[model samples]
Target: MIGRIRGMFILGLCSASALAAGTGYQPPFHPDQLKGPPAGRPNEVLVLGSPHLSGMPDTFAPAQLEPLLERLAAWKPEAIAVEAVSGLQCDYMRRNPARYADSVSSYCVDTGPAQAATGLDVPAANAEAERLLAQWPATPSAAQRRRLAAVWLAAGERNSAVVQWLRLPAEQRIAADGMTDALVAFLDKRLQRRDESVLVAATLAARLGLERVWAVDDHTADSPTPKEVEKAAADAITKAWDNPYSKARAAADIPLYANVAQPDGLLAIYRAYNAPESAMQTYRSDFGAALVEPSPQAFGRNYVGYWETRNLRMVANIRDVVGQTPGMRLLAIVGASHKPYYEAYLNLMHDVQLVDAEDVLR
Candidate 1:
């Protein structure tokens, strides 16, 4: 079906409604309209670009995102995908404990402790977290809040812990997952990290009573970079960002994040990001940057290969989800870098319609 806009551009009801009615409009008809029947069913998809919250400096406050998250919740997405890899966060921690050793030790209070304390695996803990959020007491006792926090932490969802904690009154946000002052401080600090976006997704899902957030990010396409090639590639990527277009865009974008609390600040940035031109920015910043490689080195090709492969796989994951549930409205929340790639790849799928995120974000 051809997509239709609604409840917008309400300039004059008589003319606008008459034109939108499609009877009196009769605007230039395409020859293809007569040439063919419709294709597959359309599934709405929105790819939202967000800055990696973990990378935000100390000045970046988590509270500023509440309004934006509230706005997105209004979209009433049936399915939501996030940048995190699917499965328990501890799976990654178990496989590469060193990678997350610091964060886990700091915030994930005594790994597996919650599972041991509650005998609940990740899925089970997630279920409990949902139940607790849904049935949260009007004025929860200290013990009750601690139980919810422990379950959330056990799920390796410190982000969700922060989310639930933020839902509490300031006086009630004490250390509850094992209840140490150090853990309380660390939990607040975790809220500042990259997982803040995950927190937003989790909070929205909870508000909508969604069972789980889908993880569609693909990292299998990433090849191990040789040290020599890595150094050169890093420099090339840096220079690409230094290019005039990149510089100007960065200058414009930084202010949006800096002033995110102001009205329409985040929406303006989201609108700019989802515009058609933003795809070219991704091309230049990512795939095109590798073109700077000198002759005889295919390093740039490797970069493009990795980028395209990752995006294709990610889109495949999304398509699989949509295929299972026809007419599903999906929202994929991902890093700013991935937004264009996701839209470009998902748009080609016959059944998937890339919803204009500008329309939704606005």
Candidate 2:
């Protein structure tokens, strides 16, 4: 599944700060304060992939990324690669931070720095790029020139179209830019017409196969404490099972919960009973209780175990790809949830070099 890039420019703008913050930002733990990865392993390239935090409407907000970006930047990576394909667009955003905001706001409803300049919705770094681009008349500004140079370096001049354009005479270059803009517009139109879910799923499949994309389970997979188990059981029986208002209580195991009369009826009751606020409160309460055990050993064991399994699988996939085409870079686009674990595991591998997300944003 080849994924069509949508809002590539917007994503470039949105992720600049988050990516920059991830690189060069200091962390709570000093380098000497922590132990390094195990000895005797080939170095591997690893990058923590994350969605555009700012553009999403509700599930995850951009503001929540502040600390996360800071932590990631402090780790310092060799390079950062984003999902963006257009070097020109990224350059524009980086130069004109304000214009980046306008462009983003124009594309995404209720988002971008134009809405709120500070806090979580702070303008993207690409806005700076655009601003810089605006300053140059018929010629690229110093920053724009640097960006073009960086793009050329990253993409390589051997067979790159951008490099080809650079080789053209100055007068011909204007024509090349117009052609690039036309191609971008054509692609953007195609993307805008696609189903968003399908686009997202296809993107993931192209980057990481189904087997490589595992559902992250942050909660404890083991059985709860005796007291907690008893409480859950009691709750299941009383609040969920025996309540007169509960219609689906008896049909909880039915496969057709959404279709069956009893089960479907009970689902409606549950939905009505559990308002968003109420559900949030209940979830918080349960989460608080679960954290009381304070078992770092258990937590670390579970965490490391999952990561080890994932890393082995990823290594196998990387090996297969390398066997077919040596020296090819494998880009993985994954949710933010998997970033930390993947980053840590990849750091331990000798065959891989993690790309700094900051470098990509810049």
> Using Cα atoms with residue i matched to residue i, what is each candidate's TM-score against the true structure?
0.65, 0.27
Model 2 agreement with the true structure over 132-211: per-residue lDDT tens digits: 33564554343344343222323211112222233334454331221334332332343332221113322233223121
Q: Which consecutive 10 residues in model 2 have the weakest lDDT in total?
A: 1-10
* Cα error, candidate 2, residue 200 (Å): 6.1
CA lDDT of each candidate?
Answer: 0.62, 0.32
What is the model-wide C-alpha lDDT for candidate 1? Answer: 0.62
Model 2 misplaced regions, further than 4 Å:
1-48, 52-55, 58-316, 319-324
Residue-level lDDT of model 1, residues 1-362, one tens digit each, is 00011111111222212223335655685432342122544578888887666665555555666666777888888888876554354455446553444333433334365576667777788777778868876666666766776676666665545555555567877755454565567567765555634566866775775545676765443333454555565554455446666676777778777766666565566667777787787667555655454423444444555566667888888888888888788888887777887876776676677777777766
